[model samples]
Target: MNHGAFRPIELRAPEGSVVDVRDDAPAGAHGEVRKRAVSVALGALSQIIPDLVSGDLCGTSFPNAIGE
Candidate 1:
């Protein structure tokens, strides 16, 4: 990937939102936030290029419990 090829991103999320946290927000759970971010970006891109983008990804990494 060419880092210099793309311009810097300027995101403007509402204060105290999931992506924008306060100084004393809860710790951990960054993975979940990252997954949702990717899904959102893909969804936006899908609108312009529907054929290139696939379905939304599963926004989770938790393992399901199996019954005996």
Candidate 2:
């Protein structure tokens, strides 16, 4: 991740969640994790500003943005 770009950003996720990684976890999944995080953030924001924020737009399977 570009730590410099998000220098002042602070995130507090629960332990063992997708966003929270343990030392034994495999590496090189940052991009995937980031995408899921974005989806989650947008979903949260939609609750506060439904009209302004887009919903169910993520492409990953984690959130199942588009159901079968």
Candidate 3:
């Protein structure tokens, strides 16, 4: 089965931006940072693919596990 023609794809993170945070701010707080980033990304993706992502996003059972 032919998949189809190739299409160009590009992904970039700006310098010093939150999407690509600098090293000096906080290394230990990466867990919080990661959650925020995922929310932003998944929020965007859900708009286009809501069904696939519907049940994928949920609250953590162990809320305090990540210092949240």
Which candidate leads in TM-score?
1
Off by over 4 Å in 2: 1-9, 14-17, 51-68
Per-residue C-alpha lDDT of model 1 across residues 1-68, encoded as one tens digit per residue: 47665455577889788888888986367677878887998799789988776677777876454556
C-alpha lDDT score of every prediction, in listed order: 0.76, 0.68, 0.60
Cand. 1 TM to true fold: 0.59
State the lDDT of candidate 3 residue by residue for 1-68, as single tens digits.
Answer: 25744333454889687657787754665566666666766788789978655333353333344665
The deviation in Å at residue 34 for candidate 3 is 1.0
Candidate 1 residue spans exceeding 4 A from truth: 5-8, 50-58, 63-68
| Residue 37 lDDT, candidate 2, scale 0-100 | 80
The total number of steric clashes, by the backbone 3 Å criterion, in model 3 comes to 0
Per-residue lDDT of candidate 2, residues 1-68 (tens digit):
56554335378988766677777775455667787788888788779878776556556645333434
C-alpha root-mean-square deviation, each candidate: 5.6, 8.0, 6.2
lDDT of 2 at 53: 65
The local distance difference test score of model 1 is 0.76
Which ranges in model 3 have alpha carbons more than 4 Å from their true place? Answer: 1-11, 54-68
* True-vs-predicted CA distance for residue 24, candidate 1, Å: 0.4
